[model samples]
Target: MSSGLIDTKPLAGIALASAGYACFSMQDALVKWMIATYEVPQILFMRSLVIVVISGVLMRVRHHPSILKSPYRGTVVLRAALMLIAWLLYYNAARSLGLAELTTLYFSAPIITVFLSILVLKEAVGAGRWIACIGGFAGVVIAANPSHSPHLIPAAMCLVAGFCWAWSTILIRLVSRSESTLTQMFATSLLFGLACAVSFPWIWRTPDAEGWMLMIGLGLIATLGQFLLYEGFRYAPASALAPVEYTGLIWAFAYGYAIWAEIPAWNVFLGALLIVASSMVLVLWERRSEISARNRAAA
Candidate 1:
């Protein structure tokens, strides 16, 4: 809303989201693999520490002079909290659920966002949007294949993570209205790094050489992934760009098989496809609705 100038320069949000998802999906696989040999606390601590250092340098060069002098503290906190919860859930999922399942569940963020905006932001929710939301959740049911057990712990965590992410999106919208994207991102990165560093002392465990490299890779991937995610939203609205969230399932599936030799069952693939298709349909529907509204206003 800070209008120096306004021009729609196309920077494919979907593509950026896809790339970020791949990086994230790969990072999950790598981190889980490391967890088998190293403690979770150690991995988290190192990852947080390394990302902080890496992001600090990047921010210094990109937006030197002062980082925190801006008005982005709230956005930073929201983004960090959302990301922290999502990672915690996804990491937990990595321990039990297959990558594809976890990725599919994570895509539920956009659907959750749709509803959250309705309740919190008081955004208009038309019949079409409602249909899409229902369709998306149905697809999730298919993907999750939830039985009576309620033992689908990872899926539940992913859902909780999605809720946090939706709130974070709200925070981002509020923050971006007044703050620079770079500033918000830098602050969030710095906060997360510091939080992890502070917690590292309690859960410190020495890792082997391989573990070190893995942690470094995890940190680099996470940093780049987050930066790209912010860039994605900068380019496109979440409704217009949200469907790309599903592509991570493909990446997750590929990594699961290629790296871990784990293959998803038929039901998993089917459910995942349903979720992806439903989310995409919702995205397209939202775009059409916006276009129609613009045309009406013009007329």
Candidate 2:
């Protein structure tokens, strides 16, 4: 494993992850709405189509000419498969779970991502990152305020979805070392789109004007979110960005309030404060680490 100055750019990764999560939270809100009327595969297929077009158009002529000829094809394919599984399971669970419950359950991902960063990538994770991830999780639980209802099946599906997504993120950091962002996006979205297409025909619901608008918006948002998040991984290790994932729950709450006029209670504010504070602490800690790393290099 080759790691260069990965220690110095944690803030960039954290910031990008924050923005990416906000977009994802919005995407979730849209999916939560669309799932009520359309099938999961259909929604994903549409989303993937937009991502594919954007990635394809933005890909440079100077980059690798063919996705098939890539040296990391196997790893990229595996990552794409995991992502497809993650979205499929997540959307299916969305059909039965409330957005709060869905976000709460998926919050388990940061822990999984950090653990994999340690075990798989052999990255040295600091106590500050660990503390942030744990604290942020506490905040998510408070903010989302999921029900204790034993909707066992959907709950289980959500946990699995989180794990798959977390693993795919690790793969993202792994490939970011060598893969072009556009190439990965193009390959992942292309493969993702094709996989979803297999079932798209069976579950197709002709979209009305509003539905078309929403799906197109979903695609554009997905592309931007993936680009930022993937670029973040290029600058910082996955473990450092793990805690940032919790911020999505905050966005989920905000979007919920905006879209449904659902007023969050006191717990939401408290959780938001903790989430923000944990992120700040991690940012300050990372700055210290980067300075120390630079001094050592200078020495």
What are the lDDT scores of the predictions, listed in order? 0.64, 0.86
Judge candidate 2 at residue 5 and give its lDDT.
Answer: 28
Question: Residue 155 of model 2: what lDDT?
Answer: 90
User: Candidate 1 on 28-138: residue-level lDDT in tens?
Assistant: 778868877765656766667666676667656765435455465655676787777776676766677654466556667877777766666565666655665566566
lDDT of 2 by residue, 1-299 (tens): 22122435778888888898889889988988998888888888899899888878767544445667767789989998999889989888877887678878988999999999999999999999999999999998888787667389999999999999999999998877677778888899888889888985588899999999999999999988998888788778898899988888788878988999988899889989999988987898888998998899999
Give the per-residue Cα lDDT of candidate 2 at 165: 94
Instruction: Give the runs in model 2 whose Cα sits over 4 Å from its true position.
Output: 1-7, 60-64
